[model samples]
Target chain A: MTWAAVLLLAAGTYALRLAGPMLRRRITLPEAAVRYCGLGAVVLLAAFIATSTMIDGTRLVGPTRPAAVAVGAILALRRAPFIVVVCGAAVTAAVLRLAGLP
Target chain B: MRLIRRTVVLVRGAGLLRDVIAVASAVGVVGASFGAMAAAAGVAPELTIGMSLLVFAGGAQFLAVGVIGAGGGIAAAILAGLLLNARHLPFGLAVGAAFDRGWATRIVGSHLMIDESVAFALAQREPERRRRAYWMCGIAVFVCWNLGTALGVLAGGAVGDPNVLGLDAAFPAGLLALLLPSLADRVALRVALIGATIAVVATPLLQPGAGLLLALIALAFALPLPARRPGRRP
Candidate 1:
């Protein structure tokens, strides 16, 4: 089942990635869709971030994960290097969790 | 003469090459994190490595692991991966012009059209330079990412406990970092904020993965109305 899921996803993702580069000239999206293409990534990332940080098995995870992620986001917004963002988030969560905060 | 041309191209692209190395190193480290996360989720090291190798998209792989580990079902995990990677379509379109026109080139290039490669290619001024930068960054990322994943898997067994290091939080944090630049655009920022709110609110109401999938609806505002023809009435 895992292999099936992984292979299917790999195939689908490959097709999506190839669609524009191979078909850009031959195919054009609707003007409405084209206009929003750039924002799709931002929306996807945002949604994923929220879902991952906050949700677990239909229940909200503890606040530490979200708080840690916020720290990383703020640093990233400030244009800190990627390494700093990663380390800062991990440290924040570790500290928060160590304080016995659920 | 062929070798000389290659050397000249390499020398001319030295600065871009340095930047590419820096980005690749960063990506490699993230790849290591993904591997560690996968291991912590109880995935076999081999399969974890396989996920990174085949999926290739960092965000999608992390989402896949997150969903799968949470008992979200295989179908839901696959769907999430697809949605997470859907952004690659626009990336392909944006960088399509940089790829040399040939069946083999397009096939290979499309496989390598990740965020960094496309961004690097588009930053170049000339078509030839763009192609070079694309291939350079793409190959570098591919090699480094896989290598890092392997290293992490080997180390993951020893560091079975990821929480002590807060690796659990790293996934969302890393993704947020990636999202920051896009938030600079006012429209994108609004869409993202709305999407995030929807996802967070919907998490408990919907099935696993649905929250994020439904959040895509927030992008409706970005869609333009049909172009009105100058002399046409609706």
Candidate 2:
């Protein structure tokens, strides 16, 4: 049932995308509004990421995950590529494994 | 030949892979975060990948997964996801106006619409540049994003706890990446800051539904007052 729901929602998302150009004549947003819309996307993305990482499902925070912390830090300071961060975090994690540090 | 053209267009539309990966790790963290939610929700990890492949919108998918974890009906979850993604309409139209290609190309370009994809496309001033860059960014995001979701799911399924690696902390860092660039001037900065402030205060007060409402309200307050810029080209 839920899978069906997921699929339907996916289609709905694509539908919204498809409908945009089709209705370009009917609906118009100001350029500023449009630009802010773009910024808003980034803001929402930021908001989503921020709140999720801060709070576990039912708790405020969880136990340590230093390697993931390393990944986030590297991303921030260096603005390093995503692959580097993922790889670094994963490798950092793998190293901890090799060092018996969970 | 045209298929390849479309493929190049897609690749070029995404920012270079270097740039894509620059954003991908943070996205990966998001994916892992969602994976944790999905795992806890008892949704199969593979289904999460399928959601990425099909829906491909991170925010919507994240919200839906979050809802599912909280025992919301699938219907309500889908409805909320659609509402959140409603902003894509204006996004696609903006890209459409800026697109100087034929109708076929415009239609095709519309399919690539997403948060970052539209932003990247509009950031460019040239037509071919816009097309190629937008497609490349969108495609790159598609590849990394879906793959990252899969990786997260795989990790989640095997690992007992998401916190073992401190993935919880990845959010602010990731959001920071998204927020820093859009602070184009004082207004944008104020808007973002105020929105963040509102989000922090509202998160615990509202359920997921109400929190999104608060985010939208905060976003509206932060956004310019909907007055069109005087000199923008049609």
Candidate 3:
């Protein structure tokens, strides 16, 4: 079942890769769609990030995980460069560990 | 013959070799995050690096790692994670149109047409600039990614108790950082705010992937709400 899932995922992703170039002309999305497209990219990226970080193993690891998230958010707001963003996350995580939170 | 020269130039511009640093900057963080996650999970450091080398998709890597860490079947994790990546299809298609297709060019373009590269290419108003940006970003990502994987994996291995260091934060924080620059509009802001908040609030209620998927759908179907006119100055 798992292999089946992974293969399905891979094929689905490949389809997306193939689709981008194949249908470039046929679709004429409205201005709203276009704007949303820009937003969608960021929005989706955030949603993905949220899921990946806050919830692990179907439970929220509040102290360590959320702290890391807050650190990332702070770094992002400060417009810290990418390396700084990573460092903030690392430090948040390190603090969590030092506090003995899972 | 003029067109041939242009296409060659376009392809060269789009491929990863020319602007290696830009690509690395974009792909490196994501690659490192995945590399570190894999390392933490008792995945052979080689496999972690290989994910960057081979998979190159951060969401998919996250999915694969989450599943693996839980001892979920490898195959299942691969599949679920991939479902999230399906969005790339339309993104790639959008990019593929900018270039006239030939067998080799099409194939290569498809391989390189990731979200960042494609968006960057499409964002370019000029045909040649579009092509060049696309290729450069893609190639940069590919090259930097493979190299960065080694760094991340080694870093992961060297850190004692990778969990304590909060290495997992790299993936989300890195991605969030990549995403922030792109959110420069109002409708996008609203929808993103709505969708993101929904995801955060509803985190307790839904699967992470499914919750996010739902947010995308809600944002997409949010037609009944007033549509903001362009240049209207919200």
Model 3 residue B70 CA deviation in Å: 5.5
> Which rank order by TM-score, best down to worst?
1, 3, 2
Question: What TM-score fits each model?
Answer: 0.68, 0.63, 0.66
Q: Can you write out model 1's per-residue Cα lDDT over A1-102, one digit (the tens) per residue?
A: 267777898899889988887667677777555556546656756776687788865699888988998898788778786667767888999899889987
Top-DockQ structure, candidate number: 1
Query: So what's the TM-score on candidate 1?
Result: 0.68
Q: How well is candidate 2 docked (DockQ)?
A: 0.31
Candidate 3 wrongly placed segments (more than 4 Å): A1-9, B1-54, B65-75, B93-106, B112-137, B144-165, B201-207, B220-234
Best candidate according to lDDT: 1
- Give the Å shift of residue B166 in candidate 2: 4.7
Model 3 C-alpha lDDT per residue in residues A2-66, reported as the tens digit of each score: 33444455456666676755665467777665555545555665565666677764577666777
Candidate 3 per-residue lDDT over residues B1-234, each given as its tens digit: 999998986775544233335335646655665666667777777566655544566667776778767878866686666666665654554456555366577766676655556545644567777777677777778776767667778888553444555666755675566556455545555676677776666656754556666667646645654656646885
Measure candidate 1: CA RMSD: 6.3
Clashes of each: 0, 21, 20
TM-score of the first chain in candidate 1 relative to the native first chain: 0.71
Question: How do the residues B1-234 of candidate 1 rate in per-residue lDDT, one tens digit apiece?
Answer: 999998987776775666567667767776777777787888888787877777788767877888888898888888877876776776676667677487788888887877667656644668888888889988899888898888877787553445666766776776566556557667778888999899889869875556766777997866554354657877
Predicted structure with the largest TM-score when compared to the true one: 1
